[model samples]
Target: MELKRTNVPFLLSLALVVLLALLPVTKTWAVGIALLLGAAVSNTVPSAAPSGLGKMRKLALNTAVVLFGFGLNIGQVISVGGQGFWQTAVSLGVIISLGYFLLRFFRLDGDTMKLITFGTSICGGSAIAAVSSVMKARDEEIGVAMGVVFLLNTVALFAFPLLAGAVSLSPEQYGIWCALSIHDTSSVVGAAAFLGDTSLSTATIMKLTRTLWITPIVFVLSLRQGEKGKLSVPLFIVLFLLASAAASVLPFPVLFKSLASAGKVFMAAALYMVGFGLHRSVVKKAGAGGMLFGGILWSVSIVVGYVLASLS
Candidate 1:
């Protein structure tokens, strides 16, 4: 198939992601630098270019998750997921409760409050997008919420590894902490990617498990708002499970290793795309109040996750 001109940037980004992953330098540093490069150049790129690139990015992420599943047995994934279940549940509860009181105390606009609450408590921008539709939030409210989440996601990508190192956390500990605290799947996966392969796998399973909460959260929100809300299931998770099952049952070590390696490359590429989506215009639209609210909530989540990880 002939590639379109619009696809050149995305293709180049993918190639860079793969090359960085393969280089002799530290994997974590390579990924981090690539992410920054993408974010820096995002503003100069045509806005229309990213719409198609976004779809391609999601496809790459799903494929990567499935392939990465080959590195773990199905049972291990289940066990790790089970351990993370409570963390997700408790973190969601805390965020909602704190957000409720904080919103009242701050007397923020209702729609903006809801947007921040959903974005912080669930899967960041995806949750904000889903909940806003049901709540009939204004474009400005949605934009602010998304901007807040995106900004925090960027911060998390850079800060998490440094914090993890300072605390001397194990790979599993770092993974669980990331799943509990990070605002988006992309950020969670990106932060953990630098830690190690084991960290990446654990974080992916935990983050995906946390993502499943979207259905129940949205259903509850819809009822409260007396409006219809759509639930989006991350089907890539099912594919991930299937891949793990295949790895457990099938006897193909060499093939599985190759698939897992490719998965890492794809993951790096997906993160690069994520970085590319961050722009200053979005941050400006978020406004000071929205940024403060999101910042507070995100900070609390990080503390909670750290405490939980330390205790575990």
Candidate 2:
């Protein structure tokens, strides 16, 4: 059989995984490099080149999150989450309220405004995808929102760690700030991991908690728009919690360690996929006004979250 052209991107991605695995750099660096490579190459290929990689990306990420849970005990997850629940809730409300007002001030159309608001206020593309359905957003609107959100997320992946160091934030503080400020779960975990393993765990749990807000946010949107929207939960979170519970009860030190290590590698690969999905045309279509709106909200979130975290 002749070689299929569609498999080229997949093969390239797999080769990247192998090369990065052999590098002496940290896993976070490997992932960052992979992301850069993916973004650089994304514009060169057909739009369809990366389409098949989405499922692989999702599976890799879910597996990574579940495996990462092996490093935690359920109690730690519960305790940290409970302590920060009020802070997270307040931050979410602040972000949404401010984002809505600012987008309107910028005079963005309703669909675009809602897309950017949900993307920034919640879990980036996932939030956009969920709320767009309820709002009956056009395809172009969804693309624009996702493009803007992903671009900001990329900025956060690099900028956040530098900000953390400049401000001398503790790992816990950095993690909480990442959860509150970053646009997506992958970027949140990536930025936190750059800080250290403790920050990674804290950020992941806090980010997952933030994701739970998706259901309620969608519900509110539907109520206001008089449109029906199905609530979709990321089941991997349930698995992550279950894995933490199992780790707490089981005597599998070697097994847990192995899984955690593998999970880090999987996460790096997932980040690589994320970077590959970035398309310049889509970002350009998002328009400068939408980007400015997202930037304003994101900047405020980082500043507000940092202050709250420092206080707590």
Q: How much does candidate 2 score in TM-score?
A: 0.93
After the best TM-score superposition of candidate 2, give how far the Cα of residue 200 lies from its true spot, in angstroms: 0.4
Assess each prediction's global lDDT (C-alpha) against the native.
0.81, 0.82
**Residue 232 error for model 2, in Å?**
5.6
Candidate 2 structure quality by residue, lDDT tens digits, 84-147: 6777788888988887677547777777877888888788988898888888899988888888
**Backbone collisions counted per model:** 0, 0
Model 2, residue pairs in steric clash:
none
Q: Give the alpha carbon lDDT tens digit for every residue of 1-312 in model 1.
A: 246676577567667778987776745666566677677667666442444666877787788888989988999899988988898889889998999888776656878877888788778877888778778899988887888898888889889988876986789889888988998887888888777888888898888888888888878888888776566677888888999999999999899988987887787777777777777787788778888888899889988988887666
